[model samples]
Target: MMNPESLRTVSVMRYILPLREGGSLPALAEADDDFKYVLKFRGAGHGVKALIAELLGGEIARFLGLPVPELVFATLDEAFGRTEADEEIQDLLQFSQGLNLGLHYLSGAITYDAAVNDCEATLASKIVWLDAFITNVDRTFRNTNLLVWHKELWLIDHGAAFYFHHSWNNWENSAKTPFALIKDHVLLAKASKLDEVHSEFTQKLNPDVLRKIVNLIPEEWLQWEDGSLKPDEIKEVYFQFLSTRLTNAELFLKQAQDARKTLI
Candidate 1:
């Protein structure tokens, strides 16, 4: 696993095309390293906090033995926005002139379709456990956000996870809150042995690992509406939330198991 502190920074060399699949309106761009990356703009409508979720979620997933595309900090130049004739994209690039998030593009990767592929129950359980842990409500059948590259499943587009950060006014109060929405998770039906998966992953993801992953989020992206918390203070909240969830995983585990039983 690449140390979160050593996340590579790349410079955008060329603006390739726009990917209109998600609400963020991420675009394809070639970086100075001669690699194509799906660039997530900090200036997107979702704001910088979404980028923080992506960074934190991707790193956490990677640390937990899940396959995620390589993440890089891509530096954008305002001139690239001027080259874009589309006014919306031009404005997007204009505001995202500095640091942004990039996912190393997976060439020829196909969207995961449950109808065509059979996923292992254990791995599906692990993924479900992860979504429950992070409170990710985006991974429904309507939007899998999963890719099949080289015959292996790769997780992508985690900007919707870690959503509690959006409202930190009651942050501490929500630390151990149950994620009731996991029932809608795309992999819920295929998930089995979730209790065992929870035990194993909770042990694997200790406070140290959570701290490292939280630290990976750039301090700039840690801002909120009213600036109630400093960067370091907000970062600590992330660790506290994850730790509290892991310590209280039973609530969600049972919820998932119950949901599975209903389906069965």
Candidate 2:
């Protein structure tokens, strides 16, 4: 059993995780003896690529008042070194006491049923579209991108974000997803479901929460190798997108308002 409390920082994560292997961000992490405080950092993000993408990307999703995991910036000093647990840190991270979105490890509960989880579909689609615009490629199905907690689906795992290449001006390849929100996606089916749960979900997220998330990104975390980027510029664009994304939210509200018309 290795003592994570004796470590000084994750420095970097290195392991051949066989869970989700495809696209760019291949899942890779090792487990430690630490009971529940596991830290995860993207491979490329460790050296470059504005690590803020993970923090603020979740913020953007939350700002839309959609179902997203509870995320925060967690630092593991060298005191928190590797444990002698299994082979992957993903499992350790799952049991982490950090800001989690109540994700429970279930063997057969996760599925692709549409009607049962339409709201998740809609939100996931919109996230895919928004991420596409920002060039994020971490919300696909392979990574167990979405998790169900207490019967509510929450989005997670956003390491791959803002990957725009001058050589190619199109979205990169991705895995199969139920709902596709490319461009101006209309989440009609899921929007209808949100009509009843808007108050419950929207109350957890707002503009202020979104702003707070941006403040959490460590300055050094945003440094890149090729050069530096104006994260501030991207932040502003995020706000603008927030303004428009709400329209998609309004569609969900329209669903709720319509439901009020019925007797049941």
Candidate 3:
């Protein structure tokens, strides 16, 4: 399990370029550590909730022993991006002045190509299981989001996970619901060991592990439009949802298995 304190905080030194492929306009920026990171702005179209999902989903995947890029708390200075001629990007940086999420940039990584690179059944099963558990709906063929770096598969762009939080109602029921979108998963046809991995994976994500990951969420990110719940209350809801989802893993596990049957 990742030490909850291991996630480092860095300051954005320079805004390199915008990665337009991402709907949120995440940019490649150099941090004070002299390392490049893909910065996800809190003020993007999805807002801070996307950052929260990125942190939660990425950390959970890391705890489950999946290959994920290093995630960090990236602080954007108030004066940053002031000279940018583009009004859109400048406004984004201005609005996202405080805190953001960054993924260590994989310099030469290529998008995962299912047609050329063969994925092992065990690896595929674990990834599919993780996505299903988190209710991630973005790992389809059109946008695999999986990348290959140094010849190893790495997961990225988890901001789309935890869709239930967007509505913030009946969250407990959402936790137990099957992820019907699993049918479109890039790895669904290859995840032959889904059943074999279910027990072992579930054992790894105990309550303590889940709590540590949820606790990593920053209080600022929890502020919603209506402000009906306090930050701590929001954190507790995330914890409860994940814990309850784990208890009902069978619901999604069976769904994945049934979905796979239709494919292979």
* TM-score versus the correct structure, for each prediction: 0.95, 0.47, 0.98
lDDT of 1 by residue, 1-264 (tens): 444555899999999999875557899999999999999999897788889889888888888888999999999876777867888888888888888999999999998988887779888998999998888988988899999999999999999988887765676556676788998998899998797888788878888888888888787677666677888998898889888888888888888998899888
Using TM-score as the yardstick, the better of models 1 and 2 is: 1
Which residue ranges in model 3 land beyond 4 Å of their true spot?
A: 1-3
Return the top candidate by TM-score.
3
C-alpha lDDT (0 to 100) for residue 49 of candidate 3:
89
* Angstrom error at residue 148, model 2: 2.2
Worst 10 residues of 1 by lDDT: 166-175
How well does candidate 3 match the true structure in TM-score terms?
A: 0.98
**Where in model 1 is the C-alpha error above 4 Å?**
1-5, 223-225
The best candidate by lDDT is 3
TM-score of 1: 0.95
What does each candidate score in C-alpha RMSD? 1.5, 10.2, 1.1
